[model samples]
Target: MTTPGLAGFIASGEDSQTCDVVVAEVLEALGQGFELLPERGAPRGGRRRTWFDTFDWRLYRAGLTLEYAAAHRGGELRLTGASPYGDAVQLVTGWKASRPHQLRDLPDGPIATSVSGVVAPRALLPEVTVTGTTAAYRLLNEDGKTVARLLVEYPAVAAGDVRPLPPRLTITEVRGYLTQARRAARIIAGIPGVWPVTQPLLADALHAIGRYPGDYSNKVAANITGRMPAAEAAATILLRLLDIVEANVPGVLRDIDIEFLHDLRVSVRRSRSALKLFGDALTAPLAAPGTALTGRKLARFAAEFKWVGDLTTPTRDLDVHLLDFEDTVRTLRAAKPDDLEPFRAYLKQRRVREFRLLARGLRSPRFVTLTRDWRERLTAIRDSANAGTAATVRSGQSRRAVVETTGTLAADRTRLAFAKVAKRGAAITPASPHDSLHDLRKRCKELRYALEFFAPLYPADSYGAVLADLKRLQDCLGEFQDTEVQIGEIRALATSMLAADEAPAVTLLAMGEVTAWLAARQQGAREDFERRFAEFAGVDGQRRMAELLRGGAA
Candidate 1:
């Protein structure tokens, strides 16, 4: 998708230097009926505008932008917005640092609507900042009434840098004046080095400074091929994941965003899943000596990673409650909503305390030892493997081949996971215990993570169908589990809050209502499970899985 704004413009032959010439020609073309007003010193000058997004650059990826120009500009502001992906529109909003930067800072309006739709509760960390000078002009009709406006933007080398960069022109079409706006566009289109560009000025400035979006994602994906050694692939995957864990630790400690810890936990879980899916293959002899871990050693590392996953669960689970508390309260009695505030306070208190403990665990000497050992282990993997008969069978290749590559083994591992999930799913009957569903959820999750780790090895089209089916099944199971957990947490929270005198009967009633609502949702999920599972295990899904497992044109 082409970016919709200035980048979307067809460059006219004249550059910014000659833009004035185009304006002169345009004024001439308009004859004596139009007036070209003198330049006004725009109130927008001298302010350093900074843009922000989540760590993953989520807003930019979703074709949205959020910026907080500083209070340094000092007043109400007018914005001309454009994107290569959408419409160019105008907005008026305020910028002040009354609190930490958040989407809520904007008054209720289109700009706020655009931002909240994207960033939501996520923190708006500074992505980039640029200082620019603004020059404004008014386009007047023959009656001396302004029908359109123009602003020329000159970005500096950096915030407050004296050297001025090339300028960009912004034309604001006054509402109900399409004809005059089109005429202005025609004149501007005729200039060189000056045309509409959709890329945001902040983005353009960042690009000029060699920065970029999507610099981080909550998930880490690696490219693995069928020709690679299993041990080699394991090293490649683990090392990348290890970096993710380390990178997220700081953010997790800062508690800037819940996803930092969520993603950190996911990486740890994916590590454990790799070990289970690969089993003995992780310890298979590489073509070189000391290049692979023994199964016993691999098992120990998986256990440690599991420990890491365990430490983050409670806090994250509670974070989920607080994050959803507003929505959850909406379904309860109006007065009961404020009654839940104390519960929220309790959750936040627990979260902060638990997060500190988590930070301490991560900072401990033992955790350091485990990570150091794991990093050393990555260096031991061989570039290629000489799979014996034992490794051969585990790899799911033709037994006659007598050898297997890590890439081939990766597909085999994914197949084993799918088979396990399929077997588990097929075994569940309506009479099965709640624990059975929980077990199925865990197994299905492991399978899903394994597929993600091995996805690059398969044809995306074929793999995607199977993945979608698996995800649907996972979601069904997930809704069941999350609601159950939430219900339990809410009850326990109510009891604790009451014991602490946070509230009395009102809190208890609120908890009861919330719990009942969750139970109803959980019951609905339970009823939906059979049909969702059937569709997932149906003929079409089976065919996709078969194609994925048998190795299509990956």
Candidate 2:
């Protein structure tokens, strides 16, 4: 009958020309059972409102809406529920016009906490603006207690704003007292042209405009089918990855969140991985003119992506260091967190400088040239596949060796990776050198990327199960390496700080404590490796991965 997430109401009407007389008739139906008391300080006139979402709409998918309106004073900065029917909460903060609310503008409250996790690393892309008049009234019961709220809104699309939902009337039911809300619901239900809002206003806003959030991700699978040629498949995958690299640049440059650089680096890494892991398939000779786009030109593009990746490494590593600084200090048991502030400040300063360097490079013509050249190369590769298929018949070359589908090509690559990982996994023992385990981690990462790139071609049930098990093992390995690396970097940073005489004596103590804690954690990850590895390489895990590689049922 009514819901909370979609702005609770007794009933609603859409697309009907609402007026004072219409509202009066609807109120008359309720009679003396309820009284409408209009708030004295209600805002007048229509205000331009804007809702922000990731390109992919992550918040809405998570049942949250993070909104900010430049033209409204009431609830100008808001986090509301994006669901049609749920107990959605709206947390409000006033909008400061002189300086709009950047991610930092949100105070430490429910809105900030909820949004920080979802929208970080990506700036909020505007979804839509509802420019319309709003008239709100409180519904009171016989005891003079406010039971519900009715809002009559006439929304229109302003010039240049995203247009989707139209103006409407909404009755929001206050929490508790469902009986009173239902009684009120019955009265409004009797009116013609009035109906319940089947869709969330925000959801409708996006859907009507054919837009959604979450435009980018770290694990974006290419839209390649198993039936496509190997080169075509590789190009398809790489092209989408290039788009991810481009999409993340703005966020990275803006420094909206650290995750922007993290994501951009990951896309860069995947490109490098794809080139290395699938180089043979991509470079194989075909019937098309000259060789498929490879050799020096391909190597140059790989070098550029690698260069971008190298630039991002230090800042992201320091970000992780800062993120764990508190927990590291906590591990000291008796140490006051204040002692670590100096070290934390040092890290922040270094990170700011490092990020600025990275951002500058990202905005440079070199980076722009690299992206354009890479896109052009990948596009050329796709065109080669198309040309090869057509020329095979005219040139009298067998399609068998040159034009294999993604299924065979991916299977061969997965086999190569599995063999490497299997060899590495089999060689691991309690007495194995730390270097060996580190090497295995790198090997496992390659296998992980291979599986991810070709996942769509495998049976979901089998592939998903295998990926899950592999992920568990990968997580263990990641922790081991990260801890080891973190411990070293912390110590190195500590040494530099002390050498430069940049930090106080207490900061030295704090650094020692953090280094000790990181060392202990690194050891823990090392000690726990055999168990995690065993689980990952268990008979069942291996069986599922084997099943997936065999192209079992989806």
Compare the candidates by lDDT and give the number of the best one.
2
C-alpha TM-scores of all predictions: 0.75, 0.79
Stretches of candidate 2 off by over 4 Å are 1-44, 54-56, 68-93, 96-127, 134-154, 157-199, 207-210, 285-291, 387-402, 552-554
How many residue pairs of model 1 clash at the backbone? Answer: 24
lDDT of every predicted structure (CA atoms)? 0.70, 0.73
Task: Return the TM-score for candidate 2, rounded to 2 decimals.
Answer: 0.79
Best by TM-score: 2
Model 2 Cα lDDT, one tens digit per residue, 202-321 = 555555556535444567678887767788889888988888888878777776666666777888888898988886677766545564765777787788888888888988898888
Evaluate residue 125 in candidate 1 and report its C-alpha lDDT on the 0 to 100 scale. 77
lDDT, candidate 1, equals 0.70
Off by over 4 Å in 1: 1-47, 71-100, 132-204, 207-210, 333-335, 379-403, 498-503, 552-554
